[model samples]
Target: MDKIKIRGLEIWAKHGVFPEENVLGQKFVISADLYTNTRSAGKSDDLTQSIHYGEVCQFMKTFMEEHTYQLIETVAEKLAEELLLVFEHLQGIRLEIAKPWAPVGLPLDTVSVEISRFWHRAYLALGSNLGDKEAYLRQGIQGLQDRKDCRVTAVSSFLRTAPYGGVAQDDFLNACLELDTLLTPEELLDVMHEIEQEAGRERLIHWGPRTLDLDIIFYDDIVYDTPELHIPHIDMQNRDFVLNPLAELCPAYRHPLLKKTVEELKNALTEPEEAHAK
Candidate 1:
């Protein structure tokens, strides 16, 4: 990653809890470190290959002046998201918003809010065994795509597979997708749950059946385990339904803990005595 630094860019904006402060704008100093791949720009000396700091500064100024928010936290968050969304070359950002004229009764040099935000790559497994299976899968994909913070980068062909867990349920439609998202793991889970609920999912049985099932299989090669969620989904390697679709989207994607590629995992799984697929 390369850096594009912009420091002490000053702007006048109305944002505060106090009425007087809102009426009379105050000076805000903003600084940002934009992350990206500048190799092309450096090699070709082409401005188009790099993020333009001048354009970014102008965008920040315009954005700050146009919006009115009570908290600098909100300003920083909104600004960071907008910059990432607007600038294709920018991969991440560390932004700081300093309020020189704080309304605090005590004398202080400045009050500021700083945050680092970046896009993350995540893989998900999608499954549906109930009514309108394919429709539910499409709805789940669309739900994720509809969010500004998430992008569906690739989708695998949906496959029909026999039910796991010996629940005697109908065959399931399963698939996988690659996601580029700004949401954290927990946040992404919440979104998945929301999408599942929208499709009328119920969790009465353990892997029994559902309208939609969205599982986070991987997040940026990081291993995460908690009571509520687990990355590199615990049992994905043994399930052909998951591995088959995943191999389609990312055959070389390695599991952090298992250290095996999707293709390898799929090939290694021992076929059940009863066929797992229709």
Candidate 2:
């Protein structure tokens, strides 16, 4: 990724925790580093191929003036989101909001809050075994698409598979999806849980039957495990239900820790499973 930097743009606004500060107003300096690929603009010498810093400055000025928040953290956060949303070309951004001339009446000249925000790629495994299974899977994808921070890019055709974990249940409709989102992994998990609830899913038993089940199998090659969730999805490599549909959409996407392609992993499971049924 390349960079387009906007430095030390100042905004005088009514923003602070204290009543006196909000009423009196103060000066805040803001800076941003917009991340993107600028190859097209460089080669073509085209304005349309690049982000316009001048336009961004005007946007920041207008937005800051229009909204009054008591906290600089709030301003920085909302402003960062606004910039990312308005500029589709931006993949990541580092934002800093500085408060100068504080009423401390002593030493410090200014204080600032800095933070970075970026887009993330995630892969999801989908399954449904209760009610209209296909409908449940489709509804899950639709719900993801409806979210502001989440975008569904690709969806694999649903496949039929026997329930895993050796639990007795109806055949499951399984599939995979690719998404780009701005939400954190924890936040994304919350959304997935909400979708499961909406689909009338019940968690009475482990690997139990359900109206829907959605799992976060990958998040940009990240790997970690927590009591509530696991990345690279714990047993994803060993499960055909997960790898089959996943291979359809992203054959080349490899497990970061396992170093296996979706196709390779699927084949590894399929060959033995087929031989066993003989």
Across 1-278, the per-residue lDDT of candidate 1 in tens digits comes to 78999999999999988888788999999999999999999999999999999999999999999999999999999999999999999899999999998988899999999999999999999999999999999999999999999999999999999999989899999999999999999999999999999999988999799999999999999999999999879999889999999999889988989988999888888545336763
lDDT of 2 by residue, 1-278 (tens): 89999899998888788898777788889899989889999999997898988998999988888888877899988988888878878888999899887666788978889999988999999999998999999999999999878989999989999999989989999999999998889999999999999989889999999999999999998987889989989999887888988988889988898898888888998898799999
Residue 114 lDDT (model 1): 100
Which residue pairs collide, candidate 2?
A: none
Clashes of each: 0, 0
TM-score of each: 0.94, 0.95
- The per-model lDDT (C-alpha) reads 0.94, 0.90
> Candidate 1 regions off by >4 Å?
270-278
